[model samples]
Target: MTALAVTITHEPARTILTLDGELDMVSSARLTDTIDAALYGGRQHLVVDVSNLTFCDSAGIWALLRAERTVSAAGGTLELANVQGILKRVLDLTGAARAFRIITPGQLTSP
Candidate 1:
């Protein structure tokens, strides 16, 4: 199993959390905690960079949705960047794509 690796980068108006590896049940909590901490730190814009994310299961999707709710409740916004492959398909199929501002790989210079 490839453990999820999260790298955080602070931008002027948004915080970017780049995810690598598998975001499964075993690693979803780390993401939740990171997001909670960022929110607590007064981050109003969050961008999840999933360009290097190799796999994402139901738990991962839940984590993303939960993050959206948390951020929204705090009067913030959440965006998913570098979304492609399975992750994109899953979100589209589940109708969760409409819940987020998705930044496809081709739309950005880098994630």
Candidate 2:
């Protein structure tokens, strides 16, 4: 199983969280914590860069959904970037893609 790593960076208008490795039940909490930190840090726009994400299970999807809910509740927006491979297929097949504001790397410019 690939280990999960979440790296967070603060930008002028948003917070970017780059997720690498696997996101399963064991690592979902870490993602949640990172999301909470970014939101509480007073960021209204969150960009989750999943380019390095290698794997994701149902729990991972749940974690992303939960983050979305939390961000929306705080009047912020959550966007998913660079979703590809199996992760992209999972989101598409599950119709969860519509739940997030999906963007390409080219669109993730400073706002």
Candidate 3:
């Protein structure tokens, strides 16, 4: 199978990591590396734009949780944005929404 693709966009004060394709065990490392780079690279706020995310398994959730911990320990915040569809529902169902900051799609464009 072809490897999944994740696109990252950097903005002032925040970096948007847009996760595309599937986020499974293989792709989890990529997400971790990207989030780490953004968080420690002087970006005070990291936003994960999951608008284009097609699939997310348990590994995906683990990746997010690990990133959340790193960002929290670093005194920074990671905001999850543009999460919809099944992923969004699953997050809410699992109560993971309360673990980290979440921004709706509309809010992402406004600020």
Candidate 4:
């Protein structure tokens, strides 16, 4: 399994997490930790750019849901950008896509 890489980019009103590689059971915790850190830093608008994400399992989906919940609880928002491939299918099939604000690739700007 390819290791998950999360890159953080901070903007004026949001924090972007660019994910690459595989997001599975092994790496979901790390994703959560990164989200927590961003929230702790007073970032209310969170975007997860999954353009480079190679894989994602249920655990990864759970982590994302948890992040969304946490952000909402803090009166914030969590968005998913550049979603495609198998990851997109999984989210759609599982109906998890309904829980997130999915941004199309063309609308993506800097984090």
Instruction: For candidate 4, write residues 14-50 as lDDT tens digits.
Output: 8889998888899988888998898898999999999
Show how many residue pairs clash in every candidate, following the order shown.
0, 0, 0, 0
RMSD of 2: 1.4
- List ranges where model 4 is wrong by over 4 Å: none
TM-score of 1: 0.91
Q: Which portions of model 1 show Cα errors greater than 4 Å? A: 106-111
Candidate 4 lDDT score relative to the true structure: 0.89
Predict model 3's lDDT versus the native. 0.83
Relative to the unseen true structure, what is the C-alpha lDDT of residue 36 in candidate 4, on a scale of 0 to 100?
87
Residue 19, model 1: Cα distance from true site in angstroms: 0.3
lDDT of 2 by residue, 1-111 (tens): 458998888888788899988898999999999888887778889999999988899999999999999999999999999888898999999999999999998887665
Most accurate candidate by lDDT: 2
Which structure is stronger by lDDT: 1 or 2? 2
Least accurate stretch of 10 residues (summed lDDT) in model 1?
Answer: 102-111
Show the lowest summed lDDT stretch of 10 residues, model 4: 102-111
- Order by TM-score, highest first: 2, 4, 1, 3
Task: Tell how far residue 83 is off in model 2, in angstroms.
Answer: 0.8
Query: What TM-score against the true fold does each predicted structure earn?
Result: 0.91, 0.94, 0.90, 0.93
